[model samples]
Target: MRIIEDPRSYALVMVILASFLTPFVASSINVALPSLGSELGMGPFMLSWVPTVYLLAVAVLLIPMGRLADIYGRKKIFQFGIILFTVSSVFAGFSISPEMLLFFRVIQGIGGAMIFSNVSAIIFSVFPPVDRGYALGWSATGTYFGLFFGPTLGGFLTQYFGWRSIFYFNVPLGVLCAYATGRIGFEWREAEGEKFDLRGVFLMAISLVFVLVGFSSILSIYGFSLFVVGMFLLYFFYRYECGCDSPLFDFDLFKNRTFTWNGFTTFISYFAGYPVVFLLSLYLQYFHGLDPWMTGIILSIQAFLIALASPVAGKFSDNKSPRIIAAVGLFIIILAMVIFSFSGFLYWIILGLVFMGVGFAFFSIPNSKLVMGAVEKRFLGVASATLVTFRVLGQLIGMALIVLLVDVYLVGGSVAVGPFRALMTVSFILFILLLLVGLVLTLKAR
Candidate 1:
């Protein structure tokens, strides 16, 4: 009855709460990385795995979880995810070794995957097409808000309470969301009778693990071999899914030009953009000689601007062409990357970050709406998962790119601007390519 009265409100609340917690953990943990390393007696490579394991776990599980949500019930999976996340956070806080911490992080990632895959679908289910962008924009704002505050809050907690406090912090929020899920008082079992594709899921998991690890370790023979194996497995997955009665991924979705192009552009946008936060976190702490708390305050600006701009961009998306709006955003991002390449001034670099925020805000919401719009209601879960998967891939690849650049140019984590500049240059080129391709797609669609 409550859901029927205001399904949008219930769904949004659940999504925003859960969504906020994840990014808060994600961005904030960066500030605590050094402390984690020192306390855990972890080297730089092992320290990297703290975040890497979580990301890899989430990326691999997102699609499968979404399929499960679609087949069983979105609410049930989401509730379980929140509980798992909360439990894992507690375990992470209590971890005695880097290995233990990474194991907990992997659990957190599983929870994250369940949450990410379904939230967009749940929101889209409740809101009508015309206002879906508005809802999604608000959802984006929640995510940015988490990112916006993660560093600042995480820094403060890490400074005063210790790095483990950052993990402990997630507990109350996750518990609250777990409670809230019951109040939502409804279920969406869209594919209740469908059989899940277990083989397809196994293949996907294997492929993603290989691909993600391969990219992360890119400069190594093992990395290349893993990548090849992953690709081979992925190709087989595609072949198998194509003929299945209830395929994990519906290949027919690709036949829709808008969906395909939207997916592609989304991939590129993330590939071009996801590196900024990671790079800046290190740049501020290591290169600029800033403390964790100070670094957090500065880094929070980009996400702050994104939170401010996403709703406005989402509103415009309803009435205007999302492609044009997103393209303009891409252009701004390119300009920002170019500025990042050459700028030496802190204020100048901050200015570029502002541009980055505004650009992502404009690109993300409208693009999300467009992608959701392209798919049918029945396939919303898969579509949302697929979209997020591209984003996760972009983030992974961007990290890999940074790793490659750093390994090649920087010796023992020297804060040389050259590697940063080179990285931005590569990003600038990617955005430019994205812009050109987007233009062609827009024109073709018209």
Candidate 2:
């Protein structure tokens, strides 16, 4: 007879496996973007849709799905997510048109939302308070592992096989994770009897789609109008959720200062940093005259450092204050962003990537610990989903910003000093502001 894995061990293993799948697909695709564009015959605006659409779907659905996981069962939802992701990958690999590829990407995003929103909650549910940070750190290491190999391996795959091969790669890994989660022989249903907030879900989905679409298309009058309508709906959604007994999102979580700041700093850090890889991929390829393989290798450097640092940071958060750790990490990211602003050579870029790795390692795991630590046990699903939502939203906004900035500012895809400087300057200011906010949170944590 086979011996069953311990629940905590099972949860950690399964969560890490699932965590690894999303970023592996994502980063690998980032490596493949140039090739995908060329082969798909996509122009700049349509090309931007390739990534943005996936993030948009994930952002819109995260909260509702997290709540659903809480009421139903995390194990059930996670398994479904894995299957969905696996199937979508197969379809995405065979996409003949840009629209078809984007359609499948949205499906993959929904699956990703389901998987990510629950992974932390499942880990938190199974692991003890004392072990939570270290467990989470390990989970983060899985993420960094994906980041580490996505570009490196993704580059190799893209260069040798083709862009389509990247999506094909996620299938077996997703299936393996689904099997791992199933074998855990457990389910978490913290809010089992609670009613699902269908109205709230509808409002949020509509609002986010409009807002992201609008912001992404800000240069156009129609985009501006959609954005305004989205903001209005979002405000209405927040007010409605506040009054609900079983709201999809518990706005009250923000009342805890630590949770609030954790969310804010998380969003800010990601908003500032998420686009770096995308931009650098473009910069290295278009401006520096590097190939996709070399570009991917250089970009993988930051992830390598993250892989090294995440577990240590997670363990550190267990003993020391996570707030302080996150603050330091944010500061390091700011420094790196500043360097990026002035960087014209490869060495400076390498140094900046190293700083980014160090800073992100310090911040991500610790901040995740603090956020989960601050929430009530029953709300873990929502908390986990919210945190991931901030992260994905930040990425969505970051990519949108890059697309808008590049379209309006860059002439013929050239990363001249003018547009590049403007974009970095904006990113720098955002980071500095976030750094100050982090300091405030640190003091409060103390």
Candidate 3:
């Protein structure tokens, strides 16, 4: 008979499995977007809101929920988040209109925020420092695999079933994950005398919503005015954070040069990397006329590379400065984006996807180690949440900026490969900026 092992390790596995579900939801939706729009009578401008609302809601709530996880119990909130996410998926599947779907998507984002905010912290807390990289690598594997499978699953469902089937796919997985979490016994020691930063929470939420909404509208109407309002809200949020006794975002983290620079570098990297997946999926279906299942298989190439590379990169970060590792990754991504800009052939696109997957794996795994290492264990939740917030922000901004540029250049209502080239060119520029920032940060880290 097999002996039962450490319960915490079991918990970590469960958490990792649960983590996979959200990305599955996110990436799969991208493939189904066009079909959903046609079936629901959604305008191009309005269709953008599906992903935008989910991202905005997640970004807005990350810090607040992270604080709650720390003060209460991570396991408790994380489990609840899984339930909420499952329920929301069911609701989203049944949505009759674009507006209804957007509402349910926002709800799903909130659930995702709660689950994600505590993940790194919980994993770190459960594993020893020497083995943290290995543990995280396993977790990253789940995440990357989900990313790989998301589009493929979405495509298959959309082609064989209906777009709604993509949402329905979550129900069985969610129930299993919830059961696993419940069975895994983890102890929670609550913090006493910790007060919630209500004011900071409100200001941060308002600021994040304003920023995301403003950016999302940049290609549409009233873009500049919305951006101004977002800027104003951020100004006030900074002021509020500075004054709070227990701020939602600990400004003190900025003093650590490693944390600050790594955080910024991570933001830039994801800004360049994340949006391409969705944009490429759209291009494949709308422009190249690929079937949904084929599109999913095509997108999976990048995800598979990331899954394979991240663990090796994470291990390498332990023995060396992450500067070289991360910079090299960014350089590879820049090269891939450039290749994509010039090549319209499917084989070239596949080659670029492979390079991008490897690059992202190297950049993400090591960068995560750097950020977590910079902060104390006590503040791990906040640090993790802060990094995620920037990542979500980068994705939001990247999507908005690309859509705006594509809209301005394409002129046609339907999306095509030419617009994607323009978008990839912009992605190349962002990767160059990321490379520069990574180099500077690595030097500062030294």
Models, CA RMSD each: 2.7, 2.7, 3.1
Question: What order do candidates take by TM-score, descending?
Answer: 1, 2, 3
On residues 1-446, what C-alpha lDDT tens digit does candidate 1 reach at each position?
A: 66545756767777878879998998889879999899989999898888878888889999999889888888888889999999999999999998899999999999999999988888887777778778788888889999888877888899999999999998988887787787776788778899999999999999989888887776789999999899899999999999999998889999998888878878877877777767777767766888866766777788899888988988888778877887777677777877776664678779988998998888888778778778877787888889999898977786678777777667686656676666556655665676567646643542
Candidate 2 segments whose C-alpha is farther than 4 A from its true place: 1-4, 33-47, 96-100, 279-292, 342-345, 402-415, 422-426
Please provide, for model 3 over 324-364, each residue's C-alpha lDDT reduced to its tens digit, 9 standing for 90 to 100. Answer: 78777777887787777677678888999999999887778
Clashes of 1: 0
What TM-score goes with each of the models? 0.91, 0.90, 0.88
**Which pairs of residues have clashing backbones in candidate 1?**
none
TM-score, candidate 3, is 0.88
Candidate 2 is scored at a TM of 0.90
Shift in Å, residue 66, candidate 1: 0.9
The deviation in Å at residue 426 for candidate 3 is: 5.4
Best first by lDDT, ranked: 2, 1, 3
Against the true structure, whose TM-score is highest?
Answer: 1
